[model samples]
Target: MLNGCYLTPPEPKVITITKPVPILPPLYLLNDIALSHPPINTNRELLKFAVKAHNQKVLCNLDKAALRAWRAKYE
Candidate 1:
């Protein structure tokens, strides 16, 4: 009778789920240097090689830094 209506259960609440966005690391481009041997007749050739090697080292360090930053933000 009318008492049955009062005994009915209430409707369930709707839950909303949101996904988290992914974090990405920066991209680094490496230089393509020729690995062939160069003539050592003058100091200029040695200096050129030294500069190229230094630049490559710097780029590698930058890559490591980017990875560290990404890991810090993620974890």
Candidate 2:
């Protein structure tokens, strides 16, 4: 018994669109990983950690003016 079906590979010119991925600082990822794995069970602690992660992400993505503002705020 022979079943005939043609399978074609993807064309060399095919374009793949990927989602915009946020780039996080190494420090940011390390901090998040450290916080997320802790045995602490307090809502306040968790919220603090979330804020840190979000702020770090925002800082990573800031434009020139935003970066200046952030620097001014911190320094």
Candidate 3:
């Protein structure tokens, strides 16, 4: 007897599990919300055509109060 009774070896089992990620809300929801707001729609259109320096792209907000004050002085 060699180290307790030894029979056939255990079989090898390979299990493969794959997980997927979902990108939610979909395109239709985005389109609907975009249509609901006028300012957002206008901003989106402006972004499509507005061109700025490569380093300053996507930065479009300005200080309305300061701009109004400056314009008032000139008026």
Candidate 4:
């Protein structure tokens, strides 16, 4: 039986629409991996760790500023 149909079904009409994906931010960043390793399970441990991290961050900033100042002289 001869059927009057195209050799293959026509490709679906693709309508490409760009949509901005909405990213939902985390409710709490306390669980972020960047915060620390060996995740803390106790409030006391977390507080101690947080204080250490804060001090390290301040030291890192000072080192970065010193490096930038030295680099600026060469540039």
RMSD after CA superposition, every candidate: 6.0, 17.2, 18.9, 14.6
* Per-candidate count of clashing residue pairs (backbone under 3 Å): 0, 0, 0, 0
- State model 2's lDDT: 0.56
lDDT (10s digit) by residue, model 3, range 1-75 = 586776888898999999864434333322211112134357656565443332233222233334444555555
Residues 1-75 of candidate 1: C-alpha lDDT, one tens digit per residue: 688668667899999999997765434332223345566777988898878877876777776776777766766
Give the runs in model 3 whose Cα sits over 4 Å from its true position: 1-7, 32-75
lDDT of each: 0.67, 0.56, 0.43, 0.63
Of the candidates numbered 2 and 4, which has the greater TM-score value? 4
Which wins on lDDT, candidate 1 or candidate 4?
1
Residue 56 shift from truth in candidate 3, angstroms: 26
Model 4, position 63: C-alpha lDDT score = 62
Please give each candidate's TM-score.
Answer: 0.44, 0.30, 0.25, 0.49
> Candidate 2 lDDT, tens digit per residue, 1-75?
334565677778977999865543334333322223455489998888788777766665554445455445544
Q: What is the lDDT of residue 41 in candidate 2?
A: 87
lDDT of 4 by residue, 1-75 (tens): 557663887899989999865443333421222345468999998898888998877776676666555555555
Q: List the residue pairs that clash in candidate 1.
A: none
Candidate 2 or 1, higher lDDT:
1
Model 4 has an lDDT value of 0.63
